[model samples]
Target: MEVSRIRYWLGVLLVFLAAFCFALKGVLIKLAYQYQIDALSLLTLRLLFALPFYIGIAVYQRKREPVAPLTLREWLWLFFLGITGYYLASYFNFIGLVYISASLERILLFTYPTFVLMMNAVSRKRGISRLQWGALALTYLGILIAFAPHIQFGNQHNVLLGAFWVILSGLVYAVYLVGSDSMIARVGSQRFTCYALIAATIPVFIHYLIRNGFALLNYPAPVYGLTTIMAVFVTVVPTFMIAEGIKRIGSANASLVASIGPVFTIVLASGLLGEKITALQLLGTAFVLAGVSLIGWKGKKM
Candidate 1:
C-alpha cells in the first residue's frame, strides 16, 4: 500500500511537470517567431535537434527488448500516424500560432479531445451519450466565448484564419489518437512513439529541403537556442513523462492533471508575451476545463 501510494504521487508529479513544460511550448514558439523565422524552418530545426534523441531511444529500446521485426502493415501504419500526428498536425499548429495569441492557440488546441469523442462515436456507429452531448456543447461554447474578444478587438480575419488552422490541427491530431489505439496495444508505447517520431522526421526534413533549401538557416543565434530548448524540454521530455505518468496513474487521471496546461499557458503568455488575461477568457477556460473533465470522468467510467 505504501509503495502504491508513492507511485501514485510520483505519477501526479510527473504529469504536473509534463503539463507545465508543455505550457511553455506556445510561448517558446511565439518567442522564436520574434526572430522572423518561418514556421517550417523553425519546425525543421526543432526536429533536427530532436532527431538524435529519438533515434538513440529507439536503438536503446530495441537492444534492450530485442523484439521481432515489425510487419510491413505495421510500418505503413506508423508512417501514416507519424505524418498525420507529428508532421501535418504540428505544421498546422505552428502556422496557426503565427497569427493568434499563444493563449488562444492553447485554448483552441485543447478542444482536440472533443474531436476524439466525436470520431469515436462515428466510427462505432453509436450516438453520443447525453452526458457527452452536453460536454461537447460546453466545449464549443467555451471556444466561442473565448474567441469573441479576439474577433472584437483583434484583426477579425487573422483571428478567424488562425482558429481555422488550429481547429484543423486538432482534427488531424484526433485522427492520429484514434488510429494509434490498436498500434499502441500491439507495440509498446515507448517504441511506438520513438518509431513514429523517427518516421515523422523524414517528411519534416523533406519539406524543409523543398521549401527553403538551407536559405532559412541564417537566423540569429537565439533562434537555434530556442528551437533546441523547445525540442528537448517541450516536445521530447514531456512526451515520455506523460507516458510514464499514464503507466503509473492511467490516462484519465493524467488527462485531468494535464488540464492545468492551458491555464499555465495563459499565465505564461501574460508574463512572457504580454498577452492580456480577461474575465471572459478565464470563464471560457473554466468551461473548457469542466467539459474536458466531464469527458475524462465519463471515459474512465466506461
Candidate 2:
C-alpha cells in the first residue's frame, strides 16, 4: 500500500510538472510571434527540433525491449491520433494565440475535459449525470464570463476568431484523448507516445514543405532558440512526463492534477509576456477549475 501510494503521488508530481511545461508553450509561442513567423512555420520548427529526440527514444526503446509488431489497425489509430492530437490541435492553438491573449488561450483550451465528458456519455449511449450537468454549466458560464471582458476591453483585433480556433482545438483534442486510452493500454505508454508523436511529425514537415518550403529555415537566431526550447522543454519533456504519469496514476487523476495549467499559464503570461490578469479572469478561472475538478472526481468515482 505504501509503495502504491508513493507511486500515485509521484505520478501527480509528474503531471504537475508536465502542466507547468505545457503552460510555457503559450508564452513561448507568443514570444516567437514577435518575429513575424506564421503559425505553420513556427509549428514546423517546433516539431523539427522535437523529431530527433522522439526518434532516438523510439529506437532506444526498441533495442531495450523488442516489442511485438503492431497490427494495421493500431497503425491506423496512431495516424488518426497523431493528426488530431498534435497536428490539428496544436496548429489551431498556434493560430489562435496570434489573435488572443495567452491567458485566454490557456483558459479556453482547459475546457477539453467538458468535451471529453460529453463524448464519453455519447459513446456509452447514456445520459449525463446531474453532477455532470452542473459541471458543464459552470464550465461554459466561466468561459462566457472570462470571454466577455476580453471582447469588451482587450486590444486583440480578432478575439472571437481566436476563441473559435482554440475552442476547436479543444474539441479535436477531446477526440484524441478519448481514442488514446485503449491504444495506450495496448501499446504501452512510452512506445505509444513515441509512435504517435512521430506520426504527427511527418505531416508537420510535409505541410511546411508544401506551404513555405525552405523559407522557414531563415528565421532570426532568437526564433530558433525559442523554438528549440519549446521543442525540448515544452514538447518533448511534457509529452513523456504526462504519458508516464498517466501510466502510473490513470488519466483521470493525471488530468485533475493538470488543472493547474491554466492558472500557471496566466501567471507565466503576466510575468513573461506582460499579459494582464483581471478580477473577472480570476473568477472565471476558479469556475473552470472547479468544474474540471468535479468532472475528474466524478469520473474517478464512477
Candidate 3:
C-alpha cells in the first residue's frame, strides 16, 4: 500500500515538473532567438535533435513490451493528433513566442481546460455538475488575472497574433489529449509518448522543408545551447512525463493540477525576466484556476 502511495505521489510530482518545464518553452525559445534563430529554425532544431532521443526510448520500450496491432482507424487518428497537436501547435507557439512575453504565452497556453470541456461536449458526455460549472468560471477568471500586466504594453499586432496562436495551440493540445487518450488504452503510457513524439515529428520535418531551407537554423554558441536545452528539457522530457500523467490521472484531475502551471511561470519571470505580475493577469489566473477547481470540486459532489 505504501509503495502504491509513493508511486502515486511520484507521478504527481513528475507531472507538475512537466508543466513547469513546458511553461519555460517560450522563455528558452526567445532566449535562443536573441542570437537570431527564427521560429522555423527553432522548430527544426528542437524536433530534429530530439528525434534520436524519442526514437531511442520508443525502441527500448517496444523491446520490453511489444505493441499490439492498432487498427487502421486508430493509426489514422494518432497521426492527426500528433501532427496537429505536436507539430502544428509547437510551430504556432514558437511563432507566438517571437512576439510575446513567456509569461503571457504561458497564461494563454493554460487555456486548454476550456477546450477539453468543449471536446467533452462534442462526445455527449453525461453532464457537467454545479461544482464544475463554478470551477470553470473561476479558472478563466484566474487566467485573466495572472497576465493582465504584460498584455497591455506589447505591440497591438503582436498581441493579437500572440493571443491567436496560443489559443489555437491550446485547442490543438486538447484534440491531441482526447485522441491520444484512446491510443493509451491500447499501448502503455510510456510507449504512447514514444509513439506520439515520433508521430508528431513526421509533419514537423516536412514543415521545415516547405517553409524554411535552413537559413534560419545557423546559430552561434548561445542560441545552440539554449535551443538544445529547450528541446531536451522543455520538449522531450517534460512532454513524455505529462503524457504519462494524463494516463495515470483522469484528464479532469490532470487538467486541474496542470492549471497551476502559470503560477510557476509568473514567479520565474519576476526573478529572471524582471517582469512583474499585474492586477489584471492575477485576476485572470484566478478565474482560470476557479474554473479548473470547479471541474474537480464538482466531481466530488456527484
Q: List the residue pairs that clash in candidate 1.
A: none
Per-residue lDDT tens digits of candidate 3, residues 28-78? 776777776678778877877788898998889878888787888887877
**How much is 165 displaced in model 2, in angstroms?**
0.3
Report the number of the highest-TM-score candidate.
1
Model 3 segments more than 4 A misplaced: 146-157, 243-253, 296-302
lDDT tens per residue, model 2, 1-302: 99999998899999999999999999999999999999999998898899899899989998998877889988998999988898999999999999999999999997899999999999988799999999999988888888899888756789999999999999999999899988877877887778888999899889889988779758999999999999999999999999889879988888789999999999999999999899999999999999999999889887
List candidate 1 stretches off by more than 4 Å: 155-157
* Overall local distance difference test of candidate 3: 0.74
Candidate 1, residue 66: how far the Cα is off, in Å: 2.3
What lDDT score goes with residue 187 in model 2?
70
lDDT of 1 at 231: 94
lDDT of 2 at 143: 89
